[model samples]
Each structure stands twice: as structure tokens, then as C-alpha cells.
Target: MVNSSEQAHTEIGPLYPTYEALRTAAQPVHPSSSARRLLWMLNGPLHSAITVLSSEITTHGVNMPSEPLYDPATDIWHPIAQEPVSTPKVSSVTVGVCQLEEWGFTWCDMHEGHADPPELEDEE
Candidate 1:
């Protein structure tokens, strides 16, 4: 059966035209040896953090009120009911890596150091 999140995704349409488009847009960084090692060290933590945050957001809702409640004692309004945030599941380490890359976190690459040098501007 299709989950509510899947139904929401269907309703909202895709965030990208295609998966290829998403990869292109990610502009994945080519890491140096040091950066590569850093990324290797970070991968597990990053993946765990993403998973935890995604779970929290899905479980606790996005703080959006489905219904409002008013308190006469202090004249305060609060959410009577909250609507859970519909988010696509981060199913794997690869998915987490892709998200980090897309957000310019630069920890996706796992190749030998071969980053392009920065271009220098010509002095007038």
C-alpha cells in the first residue's frame, strides 16, 4: 500500500525533473586526500544524523496546526492538532550522501584527490 508520504509526493510532483537533473544540480565536490579522509570519517555520523532528524521531523510533525485551541485564562492560542510533515524517506547512506552533496556539504566523493584548481583572475 502507498504511504501517506508517497501520496503527498505524488500530489506535490517531483522536486527535480529527473534523477540525472538532481545529480547535475548537486555539483558534487572532488575531494583532496585530506578531505577524502575527513569524509570517510564523517560518513557514518552524517548518515545517522540525517536519519535521526528525518525521523524526528516525521514523528513530531512540522509544528503546523491542523486545528487551533484558545485558552481563556492567559489569552493564548495553541495547536489542538498538529500535521506531520510529509518527507521522503532517507533509506540509505547513499541517499544521505546525495542530500549532503545537494546542500553543498561536499562529503560525497570517494575518489583519489583530483580536484580542479581555483581559477585566478587576471590583474589589470
Candidate 2:
């Protein structure tokens, strides 16, 4: 059985397979060609930098912006790519739970709430 935390999914990013991974894949493309493809796909310098460093995998190519011709560039169209970032991106995620039961005040909640002398019920 798959764990709730585990996912049945593929996460394709700027560097999906990774340089090392691409080097080991079944039908590996040339690393230089790969880098060029990656550089071309990115919107600009910062985006390319973030991908080169943070993304799972980037096209195996030399992707310096100032030297476009030094390596050239292109994009590999396929299911492998889902999206591209045009700017430095910060991401966030949310987790959902159905029912989480706690035994006691989990630290501070232990001393919280109106457990002090019960206020005398106002006499009608």
C-alpha cells in the first residue's frame, strides 16, 4: 500500500532528471545540447540561474545569458516539461487533515482556557 505521504506522480522541473541523472538515462541527449535547450527555455538570467541551481533538472547545455552564442539554445517539447518560470519564484504549500486527536495540552494549551475557579453562575 502506498503511504499517505507518498505520491504517485512525476515532478518535472527545469532540471528534472538532473545532469547526473540525464547522463545515466536510457536515451541520454548530449549534455551541451541539453544545456542550450534549458537556457533557451528560461525567460531570462535569474530564471535560468534559479533553474540551474534549484530545479530538479535543466536542459544539459551552457546557459549563460551574456554569451548566448557560446552555447546557443533550444527547448525540448514534450511531456517532460510542464512549465517555466520567468522570475525568481518562492513557493508555498498547504496540508489538510481530517481529524487529529490530542491527549493533553501539547505544551502551552495545557495551561490555557477557563480552568481557573469557575465563575459563580449568576443568580437569576
Indicate which candidate wins on TM-score: 2
Stretch of 10 with least lDDT, candidate 1: 84-93
TM-score for candidate 1, residues paired by index? 0.16
lDDT of 2 at 124: 88
lDDT string, candidate 1, 16-124, tens digits: 3333343467743332222111111234443222211111122334333222133456765433112222122111122345665565444435332546656889999
lDDT of 2 by residue, 9-123 (tens): 3232232344344335554444332233343443555434322322334434444333222222464333223332212221222334433434343534766664585789889
Work out the TM-score per prediction.
0.16, 0.19
lDDT over C-alpha atoms for residue 41 of model 1: 22
- In order, candidate lDDTs are 0.36, 0.37
lDDT accuracy of residue 27 in candidate 1: 41
Report the lDDT of model 2 for residue 106. 56
Q: Which predicted model would earn the best lDDT?
A: 2
Clashing pairs in 1: none
Regions of candidate 2 where Cα sits further than 4 Å from its true position: 8-16, 25-27, 30-124
Candidate 2 local distance difference test against the native? 0.37
